[model samples]
Target: MMSTLAERIQKQDQRALAKAITMVDNDHPDKLSLLSEISGQEKKAHFIGLTGSPGAGKSSLVDRLITHIRNMDKTVAVIAVDPTSPFSGGALLGDRFRMHKHFADPGVFIRSMATRGSLGGLSRSTKDAIRVCDAFGFDYILIETVGVGQSELDIMKVADTTALVLTPNSGDVLQIFKAGIMEIADVFVINKADLPGVQKLKTQLKEFLHIADPKSWQPPIVETISTEHKGIEAFFEACEAHKKFLNETDAGKQKRKEQLTYEVYELMREELWKDVERFIGDDPSKEIALQKENDPYQLAKEWLSEWREKGGGS
Candidate 1:
């Protein structure tokens, strides 16, 4: 059944992709094994991350970019990470509404994910979904995160290029910069270009970019009216240029190596937590109380000593 499902996913079956994503989201025991089996089949897809403050038209910009990419005969996969509702523990999934026109296009695949309390601005299931898309041979994979705050900056680690979308007169540009967005942006986009203060925003961004002293590559600012599908081509061109620049520079390769190293560490941490949970069973209160009562360092030492004595650490 797993192999059949994997085959279906590799064929780009939407239903299969959805099921695979659910398996990962639920953290099924078989998920890791399945991902491992399919790991070798995955291809490298061009990853683009779009982030900004809420109401910056990120969804619309993504919609336009998808349409543009489709017109160029590229198969695109989109992972739209929505803010989870605290009361319901469910995503509103509102980003899909913006890209409704592409619902019937086979060349495009869209999945909405809830951040689900992930501090990094992406859902745990998102990486798996992207892998599935890559295995299915998508030409481009675009990730759109809920425009929250600093956490959205995490997208830089996963995306090949990160585009920070903003709007004219939003008055949040400075705040975003202050929030540490400058370091993650490969391209800065001022959406809703027809609005007043567009040039002022552009000038401000240029000045700020200079002051930020981004490593080697200076981030380019692009203007677009996403709702009208204007300037989208230029935005894509900028992305391509960034990709070229990355391929030509040592910095890009070093960044990729570091990203892989982090991923390995993340995977190891998850595995260790899973094993600990399995050993502790459903009730971890005892362990929690022990750690709270004793110093954390001492508690860790005690646990390690116990595990070692029991031959479990090996």
Candidate 2:
């Protein structure tokens, strides 16, 4: 069944792709096997991540980028990570509405994902979703993160190239610098450049960069008015250049290695936590004990010890 689904996905069937993504998001028990089958071979789609504060016009820029990329005669997949809805636990952003013109374009696939309690602005299954899109044969994969400030650095772990979107008049530069965002960003995009404070924002960014004194591959800053579709080409050019640097230098290879290492540890941690949860949840005695005990640390230690003794992780 999984093999057939993988085959359909390889054939570029959108239904199959959507099904695979649903399986991943729901954390289906067979998801690891399905992902492993599909990832047996590597795909070359460039993964670009755009992240920043809310109201930074990330979705607008992404819509423009979609048009730009499509004009190049290439296919693209978009994963817009949105904050979970307070009541439904589903993605709150209706990204498709903004880019609805592409609804008839078979070459463009867009999916909105909820962060689902992850502190970082990405879902736990996001990387897996990316691989699923790669398997479906896209020329590029754009990951638009939930615009939560500072903690969106997890994009570095998943994206081949990361573009940080900043807007003018927001006094965001200093906060970005303090949050160490300037250090990880490969490309800086000053979106909403037509605003009054554009120059000041650029000046502040330059001063900060000079103070930062980056070791290698200085990040490029591109001004963009996404609403007007201005600077879209330059924004992509900067991202393409960063992709080139990653390809030519040892930096890209090192990043892939680090991502793989992170994935291994993350997957293990997730699976282990699930096992422990199931163990405790299924036991009435454990539930009663939890009600009786007020000391969480001691209860946690006892549970781990008991789980291990019962061949839970052994």
Candidate 3:
């Protein structure tokens, strides 16, 4: 059954692709088997990440980019992450509404995922979802983050080219520097360029770039009016250039290797924490903070010691 699904995904069947992604998102019983079967089938789909502050017009830019990319005869997939609802633990999935024009195009596939309270603005399953899309043979896989703030820098983990969108006079230039966004961004897009302070924002970005003194890739700051369909081509050209730069310098290869390592450790940490949770559940008052609980540090130490002594999971 999993192989059947994998074959359907490889054939670029959108429905099958969506089903497989749902399996990954829900952590379905067969997810690991499905993923293992499809692991090496992901070709070379470019992974582009779009992130910035709320109201930065990231969805708008992405919508326009989809049109541009399709014009060039390429297929695309999007994963738009939205804030999780506290009450229901669900997402409004409003990004679908924003990019609904592409819905009728079979070559374009879009999925909205809830952040589920993830501080990094990406859900745990987002990377896996991208892999699923890649295996399905999309030419590009674009990820739109929840657009929170600095901590959203986790884009570095999954994207080959990350574009940070901002608006004129938004004070995002200063914010990006403070949040170390400058280090992760491959392209800086100043959206709503027709507004006031456009040039001023550009000037500030250039000054920061100079101070950063980048060696291999000096991130290009492009002004865009996404509403008017302006600068979309330029934004894509910059992205293409950056991709080429990464390939030529082999920096992209090294970065991807490092990110894969991070993903491994991240998964291990999650599994270990789940074990800890199970241990606490067996003795809530003593393991967790319930009046008789031990300090968190000591509790962690004891768990580690016991885990080692038991040779893990015994």
In order, what lDDT does every prediction score? 0.80, 0.87, 0.83
lDDT of candidate model 2 versus the reference: 0.87
**TM-score of predicted structure 1:** 0.88
What is the lDDT, from 0 to 100, of the residue 251 in candidate 3?
92
lDDT-sorted candidate list, best first:
2, 3, 1
How well is each residue in 1-314 modelled by candidate 3, as lDDT tens digits?
Answer: 35599899998788899999999889898987888788865357998999888888998899999999999999999998877766778777655776778899998999987777575456678878988998988999999886666336778788999998889967857776887776778999999999999988988888888888657788999989999999999999999999999888889889878878987888788777778667667774553455666477886787678667866654
Q: How would the candidate models be sorted by TM-score, starting from the highest?
A: 2, 3, 1
Q: Give the range where candidate 2 is weakest over 10 consecutive residues by summed lDDT.
A: 145-154
Q: 21-123 in candidate 2: lDDT tens per residue?
A: 9999999988999899899887669999998888899999999999999999999999988787556777666556978899889999998877775755566
40-120 per-residue lDDT for model 1 (tens digits): 753567899999888899988888899899999998999988788666777776557767899889899888877775753
Candidate 3 Cα misplacement greater than 4 A, ranges: 1-3, 85-87, 284-289
Which regions in candidate 1 have their CA more than 4 angstroms from the true location?
1-3, 278-314
Best by lDDT: 2
Roughly what TM-score does model 3 have, to 2 decimal places?
Answer: 0.92
